[model samples]
Target: MAIAASTSSPVRMKRRSSAHYRLRRRVRKGALGVLILLVLAYTLFPYYWAIVSSTKQGAELYTTAFLPALNFSYYRQLFDNPVFMGSLLNSVFVATGTTVVSLALGIVSAYALGRLDFPQKRVVLMAILMISIFPQVAVLSGMFELINALGLYNRPSALIVTYLLSTVPFTTWILTTFIREFPRELEEAALIDGCSHFRILTRILLPLMGPSLASTGILAFILAWNEFLFALTFMLTDENKTVPVAIGLIGGTTRYEYPFGQIMAASVTVTLPLIIVVLIFQRRIVAGLTAGAVKG
Candidate 1:
């Protein structure tokens, strides 16, 4: 009876330990789920509120309400305004141009930086990093002078050139990371096949880099699309203005009055494209960002 009791005591302790671990795991999962929900709500609530606020009209806009009246008249008004429509086109053109030019240059720069050995390579990369770290306001005056000197002021081309300052560095940095992780064997194989450097980059490396390119391209587009300081400073004319500047120019009946409804409408209109782009490339973005995190 003494031996049986001692053996049973150990069995009971083992069962209790197993149960405790299971309970702890369940609690941890529950807490993690709650945290995720809170994070999602925090991140997405502002966008949801924007959508709700956009539907409110006139006096309704000032009223506190979670659900909007589902009105879309402001969107119609936005479409009717030629200046606003023109700004949309201008933003698209500038953003697209910036992305294309930045990526085109970034890929070559990244290839050189990541794959080749050269003198002062580290210094060059450090310079690019420092340039990216500089705030837009810090360089605004010099950029303005450069734009003016180049005859690009008041033109979409100005925004493209200035945007390359930010976009190219970012793309190059990200692509460099991806290129560094790429197997060197493939490049050597291509070289042995009598392929030129350009041919190898285009035919071999470029295709394998779709995820990184899409991620960086979309980010560059968004940055250029939403840029306000440069857009406001460089593009003075309404016809040349981007969406951000045009939205700020939305007016009311009186000089002191602000059109909240129309402002929200324009905000929603301009933001939808970015949201769609993000959704479309969500997978690629995740893959690009996580590519070099693990090794076989």
Candidate 2:
């Protein structure tokens, strides 16, 4: 009886430990899931509220709720305004142009910086980082001067040019980090096979950098899309205004009237493209950011 009791005591201890470990794991997982739910709710709640508010009319705007009564009057007002439609178009054009130009310049700059050893490389990189941190307001006067000198005021080109200040630096930094981690042996092999630099860039490195490209491009697009200071400063005429400026302008003739309905409607409308882009390329963004961070 004593021998049997000793064996069972150890067995009971093992069972208790196993159950304790499983319980701890469940607690941890439950905590993590709850944390994720909270973060998601915080991030998405504003978008949800905007969508709900867009469905409300003048009277309904006063009634705050998660779900609102459906009405298209605000949308109708937004669509009926020629200025609003033109601003949307302008935003798209400027954002797309900025993405293309920045990405193109960024890839070339990144390749040069990442793959080459040159004098003043660190200085150049530090300069870019410095420029990025400079307050937009500080550079506003200089940029306006440059823009006017270049005959680009009130033009989409002005916004595109100003946007490079934001996009190019970001794209270049990310691409440089990512490109630095690519296998140099492959480039050497391509060179041994008589591949020119441009051909190697186009054929070899680019396809491999797809995820990084998507990540940087989408970020640049979002920045340019949502930028207000440069857009408002450069594009003065109502016809040339971008979505942010136009949304700010969506009010009644007098201070007494608050056009919350139309403002919500325009906000919802302006946010759709950004949401779609994020949803489509979220994996790419995560992969690129993680890979760059981990490998470097």
lDDT of 1 by residue, 1-296 (tens): 99999999999999999999999999999999999999999999888888888898878877889997899999999999999999999999999999999999999999999999999999999999999999999999999999999999899989999999999999999999999999999989989989988998899999999999999898989999989999999998899999999998889999988888889889989998789979988999988877777887
Q: List TM-scores for all candidates, in order.
A: 0.97, 0.96
Q: Model 1 clash tally?
A: 0
lDDT of 1: 0.93
The sequence of per-residue lDDT tens digits that candidate 2 reaches over residues 34-107 is 99999999999988888888898766777767786788788888898999999999999999999999999999
Query: Which candidate leads the pack in TM-score?
Result: 1
Which pairs of residues have clashing backbones in candidate 1? Answer: none
